[model samples]
Target: MRQWTTGRERAWRLLLIAALAAPAVCFADGDAVTAKAKTSLNIVVGSREARPGKEVSVPVTLQTNGLKPAVLKMTIRFNPAYVSYVEEEDGAAAVGADKVVTAFELPSGSLNVVVAGFNDNAMNDGLLFNVVFYVSNAAPQGTIVPLTCPSGDGVLSAADPLAARLDVTATAGSIEIICKGPPAPNPVAGWFDAQEGAGLTWGESAGAEAYQIYRSEMNDPATAEAVTDWLPSTARQYVDASILANLQDYCRLYYWVRARNAEECASDPGGPVDFVINEIPDAPSGLTATRGHSDGVLLMWNGVPNGAEYRVYRSNNNDPATRQPVSEWMPATFSFMDTTTPAAQYGIAAGCSGRLLLDFFQYTYWVAARHTNGCESDLSEPAQGFRGLPESEAAGVLPERGDLTAWASICVLLMLAHRAWKTRKA
Candidate 1:
C-alpha cells in the first residue's frame, strides 16, 4: 500500500509541473501580444473650462508600453454635487471585443468599467471608455470637480483566467469647472491660397497667447471651440494644406480666426471670410515641347511658386477646347518625357490611311499649374511639335488627312500609268 501511495504522489507532482510549464495565452494579436511591459490605466478628463449647466464627457484611456490585456475593470470616483454623473458610453472599448459589460449607479459618484474579449481578439490600447458628467447651473465659478481611481479597484488580466497580472497601475486626472464667458471678438483681415502661399493673415489681439484658425464648409458657422490647437501669437499666418485635397475645385470655403488667452478662453470666431479654394493657379510660363530625342518628346517649363503640380495637355488640333491631359496629375517638376509612339492607321476604301497618314504628325501642347486647393490655372501659350517620321522626311506635311503622303503616292501612281498607256498608243 505504501508503494502505491508514493507512485500516486509522484504522478500528481508531475502533472502540476507540466501545467506550470505551459505558455500563457494572449487575447490580442501583433507584436504586443505578450504582457511583458507595464500597463497604466489613465483617466483623460477634458473640457476644463466650461459654462454652467454644460455637459463634460471625460474619457478613460488605457496606456500600455507593451502589455495587452484581455479583460480590464476600473472604478472611478467623483463628487456628486458639483458635477453629477449623466451616463456611460462603452463605445470606446467595445470595439473588437465580443461584448463589453459596464455597470454604474448615477448620483452615487462611482462608476465601474469592464471590458473583456475571447480568444486572441481584444481591444487594443486607446480609450477604454467614456464617463459623462453635467456641471450644475448653480455651481459657482472656479468650482472644482475632483475625479479619482481608488486603490485596488483597478484590475487588468490576461486572456487566461488563471493568469495573474501584478504590474498594472492606475492614474487619475480632474477637471476644473469655470464659467468664464466668451472673450471679445477679433475679426480676420484677409486670407488667400495664392502664389505667395496658402494661409491667412489676421489682426493681432492684445494679451493673446496664441491665435486659432477655424474653418467650415460654405454657409456653415465656425465655432470657437472647433478651432484646432492654439498657434503662437507671432504666427499670424496659418497655411492649411488639407483644404487643397478636401474641398471641391470651385467650392467656397469659410474661415474664422480667434485668439486664445493663457487661461484657455477662446474669443468669438471673427471672419466669415468667403475664401474661395477653387481658384486656378497662375498659368505656367515658358511652355515648350522639343523633339530632342529619337523616341520621345521633351517638355519643359518654368516652375510656379506654391504650385502643387502641373498638367500637360495634348491634341492634334491647336484649339484648347480639343486638348486632353496627357496624365491625370504630375509632381511640381518642370519637365515631362512622353514616349508614346505615333502609329499608322489604314482604311483601304478611303485611299488615304486614316491613321496620321502624313510621315510626320503635328501635336499642340499646353501646360497648366495646379494649386493645392483643387484649383487649376489657365492654359499656357500654345506650343506645337512635330512627331513620328524624322524632321528630315517631313518637308511639306500638311495638317489635313487627305493631303497626306499616302494620298499623294496614289495620285502619282495613277498619273504615271495613264501617261505610259498614251505613249504606247501613239
Candidate 2:
C-alpha cells in the first residue's frame, strides 16, 4: 500500500511537470500565444513644398511580418486649426502581409495627417503618421522641411511618434522687355529717334516699390554700365536712348533692361533687344581690265565705299571722236567678263575685218560708281589697248629663198636676155 501511494504521488507530480514543460516547449517553438508580431508603417507626402493655391497628395504604406494578416486601420488626422483634410480614399482596414497604400489631400488647415492604426487578434497599436500642410504667397526659402506626426491610441497604448521635415521653396518671378524699331532705309536717329529707344514692360508680380532702369553696352547684362535713380512709383515703360546713335552701322546691337524696388533691390535682367543699323551709301574706284583667254577680255575694279551700284561703258577707239559708247551701260560689278565684245566686232585687232574694220584700231572702256543716295563719282581712267598691223607690213608678207645661187643664175639669164633683145633692136 505504501509503494502504491508513492507511485500514485509520483505520477501526479510528473503530470504537473509535463504540463509546465509543454507550455515552455510550445512558447519556445513560437506556437504558444500569438508571437510578438512586428509591423512597419510608413507615410509619405507628395510634395512637402506646396504653393498656397496648389493641392498636395499624401500616401501611407503598412507592412507586417506574421502568418495571420493584420487589420491595419489607418486614419490620417490633421491639425484642423492650421489646415483642411480631404480623404481621397477610405481607410485600409485589413492590411495584408504585403504593402498597402492610402492617399489623402489637405483641403484646409495647417497640419495634415496626424495618426494611424493597426488591429491584429485583439491587440491594437497606434502609429504616429502625421504630415503638416502649409501655404504662402511666396516660396518658403530654407533647406529644412518642418513636418511632424502626432500619434495616440484609443487603448492608451504608447504612441509611436514619427516626423519628417519638408523642404519647401517658392518660385521666382520674371521680367521682360519688347522692342520696336523705325522704318527701313530711314533708320532711327540718335536720342531724338522715337523708334530707337527700347520698350519696357513687366509680366507678373505682386507689387513693386519703385522701378529702376539699368543699361549695359557690353553683352553681359549683369555688369550694367548705367542705372536710373529710383522712381517715385513702379513704371511699365522706360526708355534708354543714351546709347542710341546714328553712326552705329553694325548689323546687330545688344540691349537689356531690368527693374528694382525702392530699396534698391533689383530683379533679374529683362529680355535682350537686338537692333539693326542701316548702312550709308558710298562710291566705286580703281576700274581696270586685261585681255583674257578666248576672244574675251576680263575687266576688274576695286569695290567702292558707300557705292550701291556701278555703270560700265565701252568705246570702239581710244580717240573720243572715233569712240561711240556701247548701246547701253552695263550694271557695275567687281569684274565684267566681256565675252560679247568680240575682237572683230569692236575693231580690236588687225585680224578682225567683219564690219568695215578701221585701218588703225584702238579700243577703250570706262567705269563710274553710283551711291544709293544717287551720288556719282568721276569716270575711272580710260583703259586703252591697241590692235593693228606694224608699220613694215611688206617684211612680214615676203617669203625667204633657201639658195641664193639659183636666184643669181636666174637673175643673170634675165639680164642676158634683156641685152640680146636690146642688141637685136639696134
Candidate 3:
C-alpha cells in the first residue's frame, strides 16, 4: 500500500502538494492509484417552492460517486435578492468532517466551505453541509433564484493511499419565490357542442399575466383540477374538447378559472360555473306526410325530448344525401305545415319536359331533431307527400330559380319574405 502516514499530516495545501509529488503507485492489480472521477456539489433546498419571508434550508450535498473524499472546499454562491444566509454551525459549515472551516463572504454572496481529515472515513457519500437561508421578504413571486456551487482553487482530493486528485464537477440548484394575486371574475361556460365539448370564458384580472382552467365532475372546487397548466394573459377562453356530452343528463361538470400575475402568484378561483353541454337529441320518429287540401304538405312526427328545434328535409329521389332541409330550423313540435315555396315550384319536373306545378309530384320527407346547442340527430324515417305551394307567392324566395315571365316576378318578391321567415321560423 502506498504509505500516507510517512508524510506528516499537514494542512490541506500540504496534503495537495504531497499528493501531487507522490509517484504513480500501482496496486496488486497493476492499476495506478490515481482514478479521476467527476464529483458534484449540489444545493438542494427541500422544496424549490417558497414564499417571501420564509426560512429555507439549502443542503449542500456531495456526490463523490464511490470515492471517499478527504479534503473538499468550494464556494457556494446564492442570490441575495431572493435569499440570505442564516446559520453558522458546524453541521451548517461542513457536515461529517472532523475539521470544519467556513468563510462567509456575505457582500459577495458566497460561502467558502472547507473540511479535511486524516481518517479515510472523513467524508462519505451524501450531504456535505447546509447553508440555511431566509427568503427575502421583498423577493418577487415567480422569480427563480439560483444557488450555484463553483469549484474553488485546488480544493478537492480523494482519501486513496496517494490521495488521488479527482476531477470535481459542481452543479447548481435554485429557489423559487411565490406570491398571490387577485382572482378572476365572471367565469362562464358559454356553449357546448356534443362533438366539441364546452366553451369556457372568464373576465380578466387587473394584473394577471396568465390564466388556468379547472374542471370536475363534482360541483365542489376541491374535486376540480386544472385542465391546462397555464394560459397566456390574452387567453380568457378555453374549449374543453375532451368532455363527452351527457345524453340523458348522465353527468354534469363544473369549471373554474384562476388568474396568475407576473409574480407567479395565482389568484383565487373565479367560479363554479356549470358546464353547458349540447346533448344529442333523439331523431324524430313516427313521421307521416300527406298531401294538403290546398298548397302544402301536412307532416307529423313524434316529439323529441330535449329537442329545442326541428328541421324538415325533402328530396325528389330516395337518396338520403340528396335530401335537404325544406325550411330553416323550426320550433320543437310534433306537427309541421310544410309549404312548397316558389323556389321548389319553378323547377322543371324530372320526367316531364316543362315545369309542372308540382301538384302531383311525390317527395320523400324526413324530420330531424336539433338541440339548442346545435347538436343534431339523424333524420327520421322517410314519408312520401304530393305537391304543395308557397304560403304566399312572394317574389323574393325564388331568386336562384330560373326567372321566366310570371314566375320571374313571383320569385323576386318572395326572396325578402323567405329570408325573414328563415330568420325567425321556417
Candidate 4:
C-alpha cells in the first residue's frame, strides 16, 4: 500500500482555534455578540465499497439551528493514493450562495471550500457542497479512502447574527477498495505421456481452488461442451486417452484451462496450446532368415516408413505368446544376427529343448516398427528358418534338449559306437 499523509496537523489545529474563538455573532466593530439560538454542524460521509477506475462522491452536510447562516466553510483532508479530487459543486442551487471558493491541491491531498449567502435572511440547513473523487485503479484492495476535517476545524461555521453559539460535530467518510475478483492464472502448456494416458499440463494458479480443461479440435476455439468437469486444485494436468486415440495422426488439438476460486469465480480461459497426435509406424515386412551356421540365425526385414527404430522378438516356435525380446530395448537396425556364442549380444538361449543339439537350429522371428513418441505397431508375420545341419543328420553329443531329438541323437551316437566296438570284440 502507498503511504500518504496530509502534513497540516499543527496548522489545521491553529486555524480551527482561530475560526472557533469568536462567539457565533460579532458586531461590525468587532464587539462580542451573543447568538440567539444554539446550533450544530455535522460533516456526514457514507461508508461504502468502491471499485478502481470509478468516481465516488462524499457530501459535506450542514445542519443549522433552523435559522439561515450568512457564512460557511469546509475543508477535507484525504489519502491521495486511493483517489484524486475531480470537482466540487454546491449542495443546492436554489439557496443561491453568494460566493464559493474550492481549491484542491495534490501531494498534500487536501480540499478547502468556503461559501457565503447573499440573501438578507439566514439560509436553511442543507448541503454545503459535494466533493467528487476518482478512485485510482492502482489503489490497494481493502485500503480506505478517507475524507476528514483537518484537526477537527473549519468543518462548518455560520455568520448569521441571529444564531448564538454553534456546536459542530464532524464525521469522516471512507470508501474501501475491493478487488474485482480472482485474477487469471498463468498457464504454461506442455504434453505428458504416462502409463495412465497422454495429456496436456498447465501451470498452477495462485488463487485457484480448481481447474477445468478445455479442448478444441482442428485448432478451433474451445466450447463449453469440450470442457472437462472441475478438477481439484492438485490436478494441473488432464489426460484423455480417447482423444488421442480417436484423432488422426499429426492432427492438432488446441487446449486451454480455466481456474476457479473458492467463491466459484472462474478466470478467463488461458492461452491455447497445440497438441498433435503422432501416428505409429507400420510394422516391418518381408522378414527373412538365413543360416548363421555354427553362430546363429541371421534375420532381416524391410524397413517401415516413418520408423524411428525396429524391435525384434524371437520364439522357439511360431507362437508369439512364447516370444520374448532378444534384448532390453529395440535396435536401430532392420537386420539382427541371432547368435549362439556366449559373447553374442542378442543372448539367444542355446538350449530350447532339453537335449543340447549344438548343430541344428530353427527359429521364428518378427519385427515391429516404433515411432519416436513410443508408439509401436503390431509385429509382422512370423518367419521360420533353419541354421547349421538338419536334425536327421545330427550325430553329436547332445544334452537333455526340450525336444526328443536331443535324446534321440545322444542314444543313436552311443548305439553306433557300441555296434562298432562289438564287431571289433568279435
Candidate 5:
C-alpha cells in the first residue's frame, strides 16, 4: 500500500492562498452524494498545531494499494467557529488539488470538499493534497478544530463518495490552537523521470538553514536513510539519478526531505513522495532462421505481446557484428526473406572468382523486438544458413553471364588442335 501525506509548508500555503484568495474557487451548486461507497482506499488526515489567528495546512493522504479509481470525491465537515476554510482550489483535476473542483458550505457548519479524478487503470505516487485552515483570531488557545472526513450513506460508518462506488476507510484529522512549533519544510510532490529516475520537488521551508533528502524501499521513514549531504536552503529539488541502477520496469521509488536549522532539525519531517517507473516490452521468442530457395535465408520469430516492431541482424563467419539488418524495425511482420544471403563479401572471400564456385559460406542470424518506448529486447538465439555443399551450390546466387565465357572459348580451341594432331598421326 502506498500512502501520501500533507503538511503546513509556508511556500505552498502562500502560493495556494494567492491563487484562490483573490477569487475564491466557485462551481455550480450540486447535490451531495451520501451513497454507500465500495473501494480499496484508506484516506488519512494528519494532525497539525497552530496559534490563534495563524493558518495551518493539514495533509490529506491516502493508500491506493495499487487500485487506480475512475473517480474519487471526498466530502469533509469542518467547524466554522473554530477555523475557517481558507482559500481552496477547485479539484475537478484530482489528488494534489490545491482547491477542490467544487465547495459547499452548509448552513449546519459542515463543508463538502469534493475532490475527484478519473484513472481507471494507471496510478502515480505522491501526497494527494493538503487542506488549509485559518484559525479565528478570537478563538481560545488549546481549541482543536476538527477536519472531519465523515462517511456518507447507509449504516456503513464510512464509504466511498457517491458515484465513486469504491470501498473507502477515512481517518479524520484536526489542528490544536497552540503557539509552540518550529517552521518546517512543506511536503514534496514527486514524479517519475525516465532519464534520471524519480524527481522530487518541494517548497522552501520557513527559517530553514539547509535541507537533506532521504530515501527508502518502503514508505516508512524509519527504514529511510539520507541519500544526500546537507543541501543549501535555496535548493528546492533533487533527482534520484542512481535509481536506474536498481530499477525494474514499473517499479516504485520513494523519497522525502527535511528542513534544518543552524543547530537543530524540524520537529517533524516532510512527506515521503513516491513515483512509478514505466514498463518496457518483453524480449521476443521462438526465432528460426532456415535456408530459403537457393542461397536466400528465411527468418521467422514469434511476436511479443507488447512489441511494436522487430529487428533482424545477420552475421557471416560467426562475428555478431558482421551482418547488418537486411530489414530494420519491421512492423506487423513475423518473417523476412533475405534474398541477398551468402552476402557478397562472404561470397567473394570464399573464392567466388569462377562463374560456378564450389565454395563453402555460412551465415548466422538473430532477431529482436522493440517497444514503443524505444526499449529493445535481447537478441534471439543464432540461426545459421549455409551457401555451399551439393544442395546449396546448384541454387547458389548466380554470377555475371560473361564470367565463364572466356574459359569456354579457350577450351574449344584446345579440343580442335588435339583432334587435328590425331588425324596427322594416323
Candidate 6:
C-alpha cells in the first residue's frame, strides 16, 4: 500500500511540472509572450473651456516596451454623443469601431500623437476616450470628460494612467449702448438746450470693434442721416452738436445706434423725444403825443403794429409823476384825454390889480408804448406848455376915459405922454 501511494504522488508531481513547463515551451516557440502588455496610452486635452464656433485640439501618445522593432496598432475611440470629427491625419484611419487607429510602425522612441475635432450641436454631453476634441461654446458649463484605454496584449495588461479630467465651460459675446444726458426734445421749434456733445454709451463686447450713430428729424422721417466715422473706443457716446439748427420746426427726432465687428453688426434704437422752442418778444417803438384845449388836454400818438397799449404820465413841475394806462396793451386807439384840474386851468396872469397875479405854469407829459408780447418801449420825449399873464395892468399904467371934444383931447394927450415915457425908457 505504501509503494502504491508513492507511485500516485510521483504521477501528481510530474503532472504539475508538465503543466508549468508546457506554457514556457509554447512561449519560446512564438514571440516571447510577456505576462503583461508592453503597450501604453496617454491622453491630453487642450483648452477645456471654449467659445462657440471655435475648434479644440487633443493630443494622444502611445508607447511600446520590452522588445525592439515591436509592432503596435493603437485604436482611439470618441463618444459620438460628445464629439464630431472635424479632421484626421497620419496613418490614423476611421474603422467600424467608432475609432481611428495608427498602423504598425516600428516603435520609434515614444510616439507623440495629436487629434482635434469640434462640437457642432448646441448641447452638452459626457466624453469618453483616451483623448477628447470639442469646442465648448455649444456645451453647457461644467462638463467633465473621461479618458480610457482598453487592455491590448497580455504583454500590456495595464493601460496608461488615466488623464486628469477635463472640464469645459462656455463663453458668450455681446454688445450694448449707453446714453449720457437727457435726450433732445422733438419738433424743435426755437433752440436746442443740449450740451456740446451727448449720445448713447457702449458696453463691452467680445467681437465688436466700433459703433455707428444715426439721427433723423421728427418732421421729416425720410431724411435719415448717419453721423460721420466710427466711434473709436469702446465708449459709444457721440457728440452730435453739428446736427442741430436754429428755428427748425421739427415735430420729433429719432436716434439709432449699432455695433460692428470685422464681420458682424448689431443695432439698438432708443425711444424718441419731442421738443419745441420758446422765443422772447421784440421791444415796442415809435411813441409820441400831442396836446389839446381849455380845462382839458387831448393826447395822441402814432400806433405801433402789434402794440397792446400805451402808458401816459403828466407832471406840472417837469418831474415824472405817476403813469396811467391810455388804453389796454395793444389797443386799437393810441390817444387819451387829460381832464385833471391842473391840465384844464390854463390862463394868463392879471396885472396891476391889488397886486400882480403870477400865473407861473408849465406842464410836461410822457408816453410809452407796449406790445402784445409783453415788450415795452422807452418813454417818449416830454411835451411842454405854459400860460402867461395879461399886460393891461403892467407898467403901472391905466387907460383914461375920454368924452366929447375936450375929453378926447385929454385922453389923447395922456396916451401920447405915456407912449413918450415908455419909449424913452426902452
Question: Whose TM-score is greatest here?
Answer: 4
State the displacement of the C-alpha of residue 310, model 4, in Å, after optimal TM-score superposition: 36
Q: Residue by residue across 1-426, what tens digits does model 4's lDDT show?
A: 211223574345334433432111111101112343233333344454666777776555554323455555545667887888899766662145464545566468877655565665644545556667888878866788765654433323334553332222343356676654455556546674533444667777878898887766544443534557889989877676755455444334567777877755567777577654666677788998764343456778888777888877888788997987774445577787776422111111232322333444567888888877666777899986555433343324332123434454665577678789999999
Candidate 1 structure quality by residue, lDDT tens digits, 1-426: 011225665455334323432211111111222344233222233334455678877655543333355666656667777787777676554565664757575456876656665645455555565677788877777776666655563234543532223322333346678744344345565656544334666777777777777777544563323445778868777676665554564445667877777655556666766666565577889987763234456688998876788888999997988988886678888888666736333223333322334245568889888888766776889887644444444334433323455565775576678789999999
Top of the candidates by lDDT: 3
Can you rank all candidates by TM-score, best first? 4, 3, 1, 5, 2, 6
Write down the lDDT of every candidate, Cα atoms only: 0.58, 0.39, 0.61, 0.58, 0.58, 0.37
**Over the stretch 1-426, how does candidate 2's per-residue lDDT look in tens digits?**
011225665455435434422211100001111223232222222223333322433333222122222322323334343234544432333232232334455443333322323433421222112233333323322322223333322221223221112122211111111121111111112222346555445443234455555555445666655546655444555566554563252333444444444333344555555443344334345666553223344567776776566666678755533544342434546766555554422122232222222332335877666655544555677775433222243122212211222433455566678789999999
Predicted structure 3, TM vs. truth = 0.33
Instruction: Please provide TM-scores, in order, for all candidate models, with all chains considered together.
Output: 0.32, 0.24, 0.33, 0.35, 0.29, 0.23
The residue-by-residue lDDT of candidate 6 on 128-169, one tens digit each, is 122224443344323433322322333221232211111112
TM-score (C-alpha) between model 6 and the true structure: 0.23
**What is model 3's C-alpha RMSD?**
21.2
lDDT: the better of candidates 3 and 6? 3
Error of 3 at 115 (Å): 2.5
Off by over 4 Å in 1: 1-47, 106-108, 153-172, 183-426
| lDDT tens readout by residue for model 5, 73-176 | 56666678877776553222244423224556666556554555533332222344566778877776578766665545322122334233332234334667
* Candidate 2, residue 95: lDDT: 30
Better of 1 and 4 by lDDT: 1
Off by over 4 Å in 2: 1-49, 66-134, 140-144, 149-197, 200-426
lDDT by residue (211-273, candidate 3, tens digit) is 988888666887888989888889878888766544445345678888887766678778877
Flag the better candidate by lDDT, 5 or 6.
5
TM-score of 1: 0.32
